[model samples]
Target: MQQIIAAAIQFNVQQGDVEANLSHVRDALARVADRGAQLAVLPELWSTGFAYRTLTELAQRTDAVVAELQELSVRHNLVIVGSQPEPAGDNRVFNTIHVIDRGRIAATYRKLHLFSLLGEDTAFKGGERWCLAETSLGKIGVIICYDLRFPELSRRLALEGADLICVPAQWPKPRQEHWRTLLRARAIENQLPVVAANACGLIGKLDFFGMSMVIDHCGEVLADAGERPGEVLATLDRQAMTAWRAQIPCFADRRPDLY
Candidate 1:
């Protein structure tokens, strides 16, 4: 199996400032490429911070952001996974994630589990299903922020043959502990690698805690970024992942019908 270098970009995003955010993202992508990363994961709602209050206005600009990301992906020869607020066809806005591979949009995942506690439901529409996208490395599954709390989603993706899961989040400070624990638990239980990118700094009433990290199948943290703006890079080896799965056989041993 081949190994691919990956980078998770953790930064402070400005709310409703698309141009400034894209500039920061461009710089991050360049830095990651210089470090030899072929894949980059960015924080949730990156273009607009976690500004749900202004989602209605910002949602209309997703196409522009996607265009910028597509160009960056091609230029860097990288696969990019990131989230933004987007308007669905029905004119309702969804918390959407996009997977860009070699300049093309590979897949778009709408966040299934919206955080109602934070008034997310009032501004963003909920998604109904999950998405797994194909890349040069292999099949990759993506979930935005709160979706990490649902182990069933991760399990389903792993059973469907995902080698790694990417989570783009704006996880807050008070629940940073939950963020770390849940991410590790998902990786360990599914026996697959996980890459998470989270934002740092304050946005209105929410203060994001960026402990972005990459965890291997055995529940070990391969690379971790502290509660500050930065980036972490790691190489994901498919051979090692395959070996671990063969040794554990958790998927093969599961009795889905009984549960």
Candidate 2:
């Protein structure tokens, strides 16, 4: 069979504007469906645009945003992956990624590595769980912005049979090189495609450089976006992934006992 097509939407999020952000997210989902995409990915903390300055004020509305994504996924017959502030009850909050399929939450991954530089630790609770979801395409792994810098997380997912690792990020501009290099490295070492959706423009004082992209198993840039808001689409071929793994044999040659 042919590969599944996925879309990463590079959104220009307005800081602390939940309504506008959610509206853009819905528009992004519609655009993805119009392009015949099976899976649509949105950037990290999209519900409120990584507004750490006022995250607590916006935390209560996350559930409503998730409900909207669920409704959109069901209406469009597409898999939707997005992030928002999570109210963890008992007065704790987390930055969470939700994977919605067929109108239900298939998996939710809380951001394990919080960006301390962004003062994330002060505003949100970190997670102890690593999650992956199975879909018609294959096993899919998810992580938020800072999580991409940790190879161990992506490696663990790859070892667990994740063919595609989707990242929803609000990565900033100045360090664009790090974003590109890390994403390519993840795809190369894991032998799985990496789909990253990043936000662009300015969110408060932080300027996000939206280089949203799709990388193949061999670390090739399949589809890439610029520093502006847009959408990138790429066909993730299962057969190609199989062929790459067969040629490299990295997964089979692993010696986990030594580590």
Q: lDDT values of the candidates?
A: 0.88, 0.86
lDDT, model 2, position 214: 86
On residues 101-137, what C-alpha lDDT tens digit does candidate 1 reach at each position? 9888899999999788877776678989889999876
Looking at model 2, the pairs that clash are none
Which candidate leads in lDDT?
1
lDDT tens digits, residues 155-231, model 2? 99987889799999999979999999999999999988899999999777789899999888889999998887889
Q: For model 1, what is the alpha-carbon lDDT of residue 197?
A: 98
Q: In model 2, where do residues sit more than 4 Å from their true spots?
A: 90-92
Rate residue 241 of model 1 by lDDT: 80
Which prediction has the highest TM-score against the true structure? 1
Clashes of each: 0, 0
Give TM per candidate.
Answer: 0.97, 0.96
Quote the lDDT for 212 in model 1.
Answer: 96
